[model samples]
Target: MRLPLISAFGLALFSLQQVAGITPPPGAESLTACSDVSVRKEIRSLSSDEWNTYKSAVEGAKGDRWIDWFGYLHERVSTKIHGNSEFFLYHRKFISDYEKILRGYEPNVVLPYWNNMIDYQNPAGSPILGEKYFGGNGVTDKCVSSGIANSWNFTYLGNECLQRNFGEADTIVTWYSPEFITSILQSSTTYADLRAGIENSLHGIVHLSIGGDMNTMHSPADPIFWLHHSNIDRLYAQWQAVEPDTRTYMYDGKDYAGNDVTLDDKLTYTSTPAYEVMRLGYGNMCYTYDTIQTANGDENALLSKRQRKCKPRPSKATQTIQKLPAKVLADFYPSFNKKKFSALENEMSDITPKQPMAADCSKPFTPPKPSEKMRGKMPYPGTLSKEYIKMMNLNSEEVRSAEKRAFAMIDELNAANYLSPYLFDLE
Candidate 1:
């Protein structure tokens, strides 16, 4: 209900951008109003034309060396952005910048996200890795010669071909499920808690499983990298949207230098303040996820213009993707007590109903069970290389805690024979 307390400098910067003739993003600047926000859909939902246009734009960028530039920028700024509060903010801006570049190639290209969680059953088997999308495992030479980046050559790191060595003989290990991510969204009461849960869990596992550039700081070299991070940003934005009154503009936790971070802190590799990115559809954040739209209150009967007949919406059976039951969250993290914890508690305000995490399921609600082949195969990711651990300044114990949480959630879901929202469509 109150305006974001942006700093004087941020206001000045906003004024300068307006005067510089830099166009504002596609949407009007209002956190609670997503009506005009540019919508990003899941990868599979893209039409044949959209996919072709995206591929052409990427190929165009690759030819102009934009791909190499992004890869280099990521490596150059990795330390400043990863392993801390800046992780979400920096990546949000980083990906948005990439999107702008993408638009330069194909003004029609609005980046889509890859909800990889759905492919956890047998990640390597997903259609996303087929010739139609991002190709899977590089050959013995580690050169990807299929899908979008096929035969792509790059000068980053001295003439490299886009590479991916799937973790296990062309098959990646199982990733975190909707259930686990739900717990993180429901339980994390601070930016740092949310950051660790994500960066240490689904985010890292996907990279490590994919291997090659994905596992390296120069990951942006891979076209899939954009879709992957876009999904991550979507989750981050959804979490902020859940309780926007208090969560928007909420920034806390330690920085890479071990200093406490604040909303006013400058994002790494950019002059943008962290607060400006704390909410979607506001400031320079012109886009909103389709899921975030449902989460932010899209009306179905009226049907938000973004929803399409071809795209799959969430299955009602999996609303659990949005949040673990309060009881389950409290069981995992006692400190996350819904009753005791409130971002607005100090302000003496009442807690409001949280946003819906996904669109209403048009189909019947049925908790489809995981296939027999996938049963009991939900494994936590393998150990990180010491270099990766140290480079990200990752807290081993915290990462382990996240592992435990995932393990616990998987067990609970498996026991209930509950199917995850992510894998629902696959079934």
Candidate 2:
């Protein structure tokens, strides 16, 4: 069955764009210099006061229907920004605009991103999905019963309760890992490559896995939308910081019409020039992600790189112990094979390593090399079909290529037996 990557309610809202004017568009309102910068951090890292401050502001916006308004506006404009060069620039502006609204309630309030890469293995069980956070999957006909958005109702495209429908037998499939994302960040030297790498992988997977409103173009109706996009923006900013001299202003790629993109490209709904948002610490773009923040005077590196290295060392037992065999891994690690592999050890999936491979510390770990079998299986929800490609103006060939690279990263991590930094160890 062909999946509908586009929203079910994509009714154009040319007028709805006028509602989110916390920061005015480049054409009409004169730009103001930002004296203070808001720091966007991971949601789990927020302090009590910080979390409450953000929550209160979000609640205020939802009460005033700004959340639904953003949803409707996105419903109208998703196609233009997605699957092209404008993906990064447009969302940078769109998310910052929402942040301004939240700041209207509390000036100090900043948007918090969910470092979703760590939770790839079991997104359903992540703490961010608990009632204390965004709540978990819906019960009673897929209606969310917990989280800040549990009782939230929306009037955009008719009233409906907030929802999240996980994929693959009612559970969210595995997401892209940090190692994979880091590879994309490190390896992608151009804007177009970076755009393809992200848009085709975790960016789409999270939206699909958290189905319902999240599955649609009108996804801003759900609170997770902001956090997810915030993380996306964080990645972009981190990429820019990689080489501050050249990449900070780098914007190249084809648009939906197959024309080369430029820094002057106008964002569809807001009519803002793309260059206005190319950099993150000035004008309307005045926020820096925690990961992109400087560490010990290193101004041009991501904090993730500055503080920690991506290469994980195996435990003594791991080096001496055997590695998992391909078939045994397929049976135990459903994520390796998605739906096709038999879930024979479903009960002990995370904990039990059935038939461990012999530890061969002598052999050098191989870089991510996705085999033909690995390339064939991806998150079922992460499908960008031909119809979706046409709707989003995505290049079909580029999509296939991007998926291969993403899958290759997955294969590499599996081959290395990389334990997710996000998962907890129970002894």
Candidate 3:
């Protein structure tokens, strides 16, 4: 007996209906399986060229050195840490949503080609891999090969590589000090400084994901950086839901390199507003955390409500207490902070707080005063050395020309059919 066939239009309509009604089972929303069906479908449809172009834009050099650091860090940290499906599932969903945004406007966005030149150890192998690529003077072929892998270990260490390169080892070590973590955990340091440190650290991750060098644009490195960052963006969104006061936790604003990023300033996936990025991923992104527990029994009810909204409840496989790590009890266990954030707050401001704006243009702008701690002999950990700066910044015109060449190379990759497979498939 022959089976009746359904028309493509009818089949598509049927599939849409199935997705429209799909809902997460109680307490299962945190798992990857519970991700919105439509979002996943959208991600699956992206073209390869589109994905590579976006990757190139991020990986290619243009602005500050820290930007490259952030791109590189994303590559390393994601590769190192994405082994666990628990967190990776969340990342998958985030990728689905974020890619949807880009695909809507730029249907050709595809993942970059990941390059592992050092693994093969051929100076002529990688088009963009060479001592001169990064504008550094005389880095031996051996150092370039080892540096690529070691620098891209992913997770927190990825950022460390940038710190080491930027000469911020002393500053990072100081902040990584037990006392510093304690001060941050206790809220005594104020939220402003805390955010600055986290942003600095994460920017390193971004750099690692792309490349330490500005010449390399969208080479085939890892395709997962976009989804990984989408998860980071989701975390920022969750922090916004904390409360009105908490949303403004870092209202003070900050200055890095030559740019000042304020709380009101929007983050983007591709030079667009973050809110637009959020919408691009989907109208809504459902994410559940590991868990949260309250110290005070009185606060339990309030805490539970917030926890239910954000993270998943304990599974039958694990004890409830284990899943819900107590925030107040962080001092007792060091592992909690290392594995995941004990108290995940949004980035803080480093500059003085801005007062309410008046309608009069004649009114002078007054920046907030620095904290007493900030005023003290502040350490410069990861700043580029004078020698390093002189080496990379040889001629401003030359650097600009090199960056332009990098952009053109990425454009060629997009024109080629290289980035298609990675745009949709999770693996």
Candidate 1 on 190-309: residue-level lDDT in tens?
878889999999888888778888888889998889998998888887666555555666688999899999877889867787777766655667676656444323424223344343
How many pairs of residues in model 3 come into backbone collision?
48
RMSD of each: 8.8, 13.8, 22.1
TM-score of each: 0.78, 0.72, 0.28
TM-score of 2: 0.72
**Model 2 regions more than 4 Å off:** 1-33, 168-170, 294-393, 416-427
For residue 141, model 1's alpha carbon misses the true position, in angstroms, by 0.8
Candidate 1 — which pairs collide? none
- lDDT to native, each model: 0.66, 0.63, 0.28
- Model 2, 309-375: lDDT tens per residue? 3222322222211244555334333333343211111111121111112112343233222223432
lDDT of 2: 0.63
**Tens digits of per-residue lDDT for model 3, 272-377:** 2222222111324332221111211112332234223432222121121123334422432233334433333311111111212111224433332223332212
